[model samples]
Structures are given as structure tokens and as C-alpha cells.
Target: MIEQFFPELKRYAEDFVASYGYTAIFLISFTESIIQPIPPYPFIVSAPFFKLNVYMAGIVALLGNLLGALAAYYSASFLGETFVKRLLGEKLYLKGESLFNKYGFFAVLIGEPYKLVCWLSGIFKMPPLVFLIASFIARSIRIGAFVFFGNFLEKFIS
Candidate 1:
């Protein structure tokens, strides 16, 4: 089912990244980390084909994602736990709490488990410096993976 959308998404990502370069990749990565539905994978993977330097693409993506994660963290902190409980429902919220409590730092280190961890970090009032460092490292590594993939693809195709 997800495969059907790939071609169109690929085309759009290629065009946008080609036209805007690092700015487009940064924006996509930033928004995706916050609430945007379009993952930045397409942009990262298509970056080489779009004539962007792979290293620059990864750096831009990492910075954007870190900033966006910071935004979400601050927003959640401002909103507080009561708001989240209401938003996610009692059961879901509790489950998230449990997962975050168990996973701790690893939650942010790995992206898939990060949404709840990001929210809980704020709700629980984790130290900002800690959040920033962990988030930056994890996001950098994640985007680096994409950059490597693009490099590999570019080499293979050439």
C-alpha cells in the first residue's frame, strides 16, 4: 500500500530539493520532527540526484530536526501533563509514560520511540541541556544514515 505513493513522493522531493537545495531538506526535516506527515527520507535519499553535497544535506537535516524537536519539547512543556493526558487519552498517555520511564535516554536515541519520549521529557521537566545533547546526537546519526544511503545510491547509479 505504501509503495504506491513512492513514485509521486520521489518526484516531488527531487524537484523541491533540487530547486531549494539545503533549505528545502532542512525545512522538511524540521517539520517532520514536529508534526509534518512527509518524512525527510525522500529528500535525503534524493539529495545527491538533486546535486546537493551529501555531507551538507546531512548537517542541514540534523540541525533542522534538532530545532524542531526543541520546539516540540518546549511546546509540550508549556502545555503541561494535563493537556497531554486529555489530548492522548488517559490510557494512551499512561502507556507512553511507562514506555518513557522504562526506556529513558534510549528512547530519544532511537527515533521511532521518540515522539512520546519528547513529550514526556517536557511533561516530566527533564533538563534542557540533556535533552538537547541527546536529541542532537540521535538526529545527527539518523540523518547521517540517510546521507550515506544517498551517497551509495549516487555511486551505484554513476
Candidate 2:
């Protein structure tokens, strides 16, 4: 579906990962967690194509995402709700706020649009340690699933 817009993205991601290795993975994942619109799955799946270790790629991606989430969290915390609402737009901010209000920590744990949840967590003053632990677990499971899926694809193709 994304290829309809970015026809060369897959190829570009493959080449980028091949050339830059884990650094490429980290940067891709980092920007994705913030506002890049592109998901890191393609770059992560390309790891095996470049003979990079998928597990390590997943770890690097997880770390990058965690850092990016933290950056967003802190930015929202420091910038205040009005600024965050402007940044995220009123509709999205309201939706995120509703989810945070209703689900609390579970919103961060289970929300699909994680960036919003991360920002809401900070804006709502979720405990830092709690946020960290939840994000770590959620991101690990998410990245681990992608890594294993990539491994499966690699083996299937081989």
C-alpha cells in the first residue's frame, strides 16, 4: 500500500540498511516513533537481506523508539498542553487525552498510535518509572514480533 506513494521506499530502505547497518536501523526507528509517517518495519525486515542479525536489529530499533518516545514525552511535558494540542492537532490530542483518561497506563501499553499515547502520558504526568517500564515491555514485544516475522520470511525465502 505504501509502495503506491513511495515506490522506491523498499529498495531505498534495503540499500540504506545494507550500507549503514545498525545506524540506519536506529535512525529509521527513531524518526518513525516521532513523526516520520513511515514505519520502521521495512528497514527492520531488510536486516537479514543485508546479513545483519535480526535480533540485534530489533534491539537497536527498540532502543531508538524508546528514546524517541521519551523525547516526545519530555517535549510534551515541558511544552504544556496548549502547545501539544497545537502540535498534535485538537482532534488527535482530544482522542489521545480521552484514551489516557479512560485507560491510564493501559493506554500506553495497548494503544496502536503509540506516539500520541506517549505524549499524553507526559502531558498527564504519568510516573516516569511506570512509563519507562510499560514502554520497554510494549516496544520489546512489538519489535520482537517484527524480528521474528522477518526471520521467518528470511528462512521461507531461503
lDDT tens readout by residue for model 2, 90-133 = 99888887888898888888987777777888899999888888
1-158: candidate 1 lDDT, tens digit per residue = 32366667656766777889999888877776666556677677767778877778888888888787788788889998888787657997787677667876766676364555567677767688888888988877777788889889888877
Which residue pairs does candidate 1 place in steric collision? none
TM-score, predicted candidate 1 vs. hidden true structure: 0.82
Q: Once superposed on the true structure, which residue ranges of model 1 sit more than 4 Å away at CA?
A: 1-15, 86-89, 111-113
Poorest 10 consecutive residues by lDDT, candidate 1: 1-10
Clash list (residue pairs), candidate 2 = none
What is residue 76's positional error in candidate 2, in angstroms? 0.8
Local distance difference test values of all predictions, in order: 0.75, 0.82
Model 1 clash number: 0
Report the backbone clash tally of model 2.
0
Model 2 lDDT, residue 25, Cα? 89
